[model samples]
Target: MIICGTNAGSPRCWMLVNDTVLTDVQGNGQIASASDISPPYPSQKSISLPSDGSLYSAMSSVTGHPGSIRRTFGSQKLLKTENVWLLNPQFAGAAIMPSTLKYKEEIYFFFSELNKTARVDEEPYRARIGRICTVDEGGIKALLADSWTTFMKARVMCGAGNTQQQYNNMKQAVVLTAQDKRAGVLYGLFSNAWGRTVICAYSIEDIDQAFSTSKLKGYSSPFVGSRPGMCVRKNSTTGGHNDIKNLGVIRYHPEIEDVIRPVGVAPLDLPTDDQITHAVADIVLAVNDEHYSVLYLGT
Candidate 1:
């Protein structure tokens, strides 16, 4: 397994180890990277590795620079989010999902962004789920050459639409997908400003449809060709005029207009408190040839 953390609170480090290396008294793990750099105190960080063996990481710090999502350790070009994409974000979770098309595979990241400019009575933390195509090769040379071209984010709601009972702070999340990776549910643990916690379940299919159909946040023009976040084969289309235009569209407007509300428009009515700190979910095949989801929440 690979592990990443800070060495002395300065530069980050990474190591690869196994059971033997971890259990031996004198065995030391191999150094993946001694001085991989990142923000200080990455307590709110999420990491995932896709099927193609590429590492994706998102990190944010309370007292450091802005948060960022990055893709690394692959044959493809390096990709990262622009500084403005995330604002005081606290990453909760990340996972990869396969698509029907190989090039359309994507990764989803969960986080809550703090709105520093919010009024005293307004909600400060807004939960969000962001996605990016796994095959994204950055952008054209003149535009977002090092940034993800298919990055899109949508607001996540954990309560009734436009209600005051919404939980705006996302603390943890776990996804349970079917064997085909198409049908699934995303369970998000959310908390309100009053320290109350609740579990909200969202349909993966609904989230996917939102991302695939929602309009760009500020773009009023109807797309005549391929949409902004649609993944296309690189070899089929060069970084030409239309490609560059789409890249610019996503660079300036990564957030979608649609909000991803939880299934049934409300949080789960479980008799739980704020003590829950972690969550895990799995799919169980029943004897009746059906699949069921078993969720475990830990304190």
Candidate 2:
């Protein structure tokens, strides 16, 4: 099956089942209900399909509506809709990278978000890493139905060394595997607000720790968002805990906040010429043998 979009060229992703009539594995009904399977808006097209169903990545809109990692079933029936981190439409946060990767049963999306920095004018954009599980069909039926319970994001600070002076924005993300065909590493292309491009790398372990560890605590806010961050779980009506303080709190074990802080940031190095440029056009990981692999990045 090929990955395709509802429109001609946009990255709104869907599984194109190359059956007799072209079916939509992600519920868009390849033959009869193309419109039903089409994405909700114009956004990124990071897509990955597991053995049975498909999951597509998208950037949340700035209109106060957070984007979701969604799975549809046969035209209007949505199986799950879990909120994703980053791609905030308000601050112009987005994951407009070249690819969305699904490797070793996990999904990865890299993008840039406008930071809430003290000096916002100097370093407005910060690159980030977001991830979710492959089989995740959202949260439990009661707490959250049909949405991811394990979705989270972290800031990806490349070469900053806890220095706040550096500014970075993620431009591209790609997944690489070994000749043995297992998820190996992730490479990201980033640029600063002042315009210097840098490439960084992350192992699966790096990503796993950032998410598996207990969430960090520093400051709190009323609008900090619920833990699991589900849209449909707006109120706790089933339990009859009609307390106003609930405020639709969907209890979650956060990984990194919307952005990964400087101290927790650790970016591995990958060899690259590294120059100031508009963007990295594309990237590829080719396996030389079971023991080695080569990363090809073109800016």
Candidate 3:
């Protein structure tokens, strides 16, 4: 089965029943009807299907319209992001990362948002990496009732810290994870406003660590229970309410204070200037019983 977005950016499920014919998963004998999905002006979109069979989508936000991330078509409850979570975002990519626990798995969304309040010297575009737990079932009725409670995002820095060479626009991203899912790397394609493009690599473990420990933006008080944005087992009787309490905390503060910087604190010094348009990365097993990373760039 294959899942994709229609020209209008609605999600559709397709299956190849034979060599000469393709049909919807339901075998309706016609192109899958998109009447059930509704996301506005989603010409440019990012979609991901996790192990849970849910489809996650993020749409491009045009002028005066809000972009959104939503989950559907799974046994679990449907979830969507709050309108205030994303600010004029242009989606770049999406991927699912495994976890030690089933419910701790995560779906990551990559994008760059317009900084409407940037100063004359500051860049107007900022790259971001947002993620949510695969088992997230939304929040409490009094809080983000139908919204994600484990949503948390961190700023992605692709250049040297606070330097002029920083590339603020994230054009693409791909992840390569280990067999245990404990170690991984995120390869991101970033471009500056002037169109200079560069590649940065970040350790997935580092990112996970930051989100697990960083303080919420504009929030400093001690947490009442487990930290916000954590993946708690919903069946645990002792801390089931932890997820609900977490919802209220992140509903008001989803952005983390710690910024996610690339490994080695800089972008890769690749000897190429051929106008890289996209990047894909993979792990190859070597004869030495070790794995090596290979990155492919498109011009």
Alpha-carbon RMSD to native, per candidate: 4.1, 7.8, 3.8
What is the clash tally of candidate 2?
Answer: 11
Candidate 1 stretches greater than 4 Å from native: 12-46, 235-237, 286-289
Q: Residue-wise lDDT of candidate 2 within 80-120, one digit each (tens)?
A: 33343344522111222111343224455666665666373
Model 3: pairs clashing at backbone N, Cα or C within 3 Å? none
Flag clash pairs in model 1: none
TM-score, per-candidate, Cα-based: 0.87, 0.59, 0.86
Question: What overall lDDT, based on C-alpha atoms, would model 3 receive against the true structure?
Answer: 0.78
Candidate 2: residue 111 lDDT (0-100): 64
lDDT ranking from best candidate downward: 3, 1, 2
Q: What is the C-alpha lDDT of each candidate?
A: 0.76, 0.46, 0.78
Q: How would you encode candidate 3's per-residue C-alpha lDDT over 1-299 as one tens digit per residue?
A: 54444535444555566655567566322221342233333454544554555567677786555777777556677778898899988888887878777778888899999888889988899999998988787776667767888899999999987777899999998988875485789999999878889999999999989988999999988887667788877622223566556666788799999999999899898989888998988888999999799999999
Which ranges in model 2 have alpha carbons more than 4 Å from their true place? 6-51, 60-66, 73-104, 140-142, 165-167, 178-183, 216-290
Model 3, TM vs. native: 0.86
Instruction: Summing lDDT over every window of 10 consecutive residues in candidate 2, give the lowest-scoring window.
Output: 90-99
